[model samples]
Target: MQWIHNYQLFLFDFDGLLVNTEEIHYLAYKTMCANRGINFNWDFETYCRIAHYKSEGLSQKIYAEFPELYAVEPSWEVLYGEKKKAIIELVSNGAVQLMPGVSSLLSALQKANIPRSVVTHSPVELVSAIRSQHSILNTIPYWITREQYSHPKPNSECYLKAIQLLAKPEDKVIGFEDTPRGLTALLGTKAKAVLVCQIEYPEIPAFIERGVIYIKSLDDLANTQL
Candidate 1:
């Protein structure tokens, strides 16, 4: 596809965009809360809304809804630690699965010899645990995990770092993200932002207006006019 030539360096968000860990993360959250006898009522859609968009408000909302959680664990980090335990347990049996088109897209990128890296807020432990299951993931040239960046998603600092290291003056770039929070980071960079998700989030129109593109899956690049 001609569109493949539009970018030289490619940046990707690692969780939901490259793999199906979003659902796994949600399951892990629910499991951790359930273990504490806390009822996490958010369905997948609600989880997407908060986790993908207004993540900054997540701690406040949870603390307000479940004071017991706040009393036992004051910081979300403590709760996330529990969640991490659940994630490791759940994926222990090699449960991690690639998102649709992930294999083909990654292989294609490798074949083209285009430099691509994963930029993720996930810790190296989890990213490695899940990614190690898939051999195709090893093809990624670089990985920027949570420990590598000061500011998280919705802040362009991480993506900018990837760009600074991998990009060249004459080469264009494409950054892939599946969440609004992650996509926001790419929008501020020189790379063209590509949202990779099936959800029809209300903010899609606005993101499109701002010049971000959408594809249900990377395989759609075959038909996309981009």
Candidate 2:
């Protein structure tokens, strides 16, 4: 049976959850660092954590790790902006691949006539690419990106905005996210959160206490009645 027996809408995150483009993003980040002579030798865990931010935010995060560089480098902003633009271009060219179960899961939702939308920190350019490449993009009409909100994920702005768009705030509105930051942003929106992990990450006991549900695969959700 599904987690929710009845829900008004469903919302999802694109990168890691819907598409396997996260690695491409990491590669772009590494390339950007190399071009700028920045030392970003982070392990997988560190990359996954900080990668919660998109290209622009990721650049800031990379800078924040090195205080001295961030302070003295007056040209950091312009340089980073250029790097982020390049990364976005790579993603726009259909380098990112969709995840395995996305097509089927989305098709089911569409057949059921349930309203769904995307809540992501990705910029509009990347979002457009995802939709254009995926034929099921039309299944989701309410797309809310970081630009629309003053605060992005881990802040509840995107989720709340989606709720307003769907015109529902009941517990029926379920959210699916792959990152902890996205899950944090989804908190207290009166929607159930289904975390679709790419790998087995540590469980946040605190978030579980707050009613977030963690799952290993999107296919597993198929068994859910909701």
Q: Lowest-lDDT window of 10 residues in candidate 1?
A: 53-62
Candidate 2 — which residues are off by over 4 angstroms? Answer: 1-5, 37-39, 53-61, 64-74, 169-171, 199-203, 223-226
Q: How close is candidate 1 to the true structure, as a TM-score?
A: 0.93
Reference-based lDDT, each prediction: 0.86, 0.74
Q: What's the TM-score of each model vs. the native?
A: 0.93, 0.82
| Regions of candidate 1 where Cα sits further than 4 Å from its true position | 71-75
How much lDDT does candidate 1 score?
A: 0.86
In candidate 2, the residue pairs with backbone N, CA or C atoms under 3 Å apart (3 or more residues apart, or in different chains) clash, namely: 1-224, 1-225, 2-224, 2-225, 2-226, 154-185
Name the candidate that leads on TM-score.
1
**Residue pairs with backbone atoms closer than 3 Å in model 1 (clashes):** none
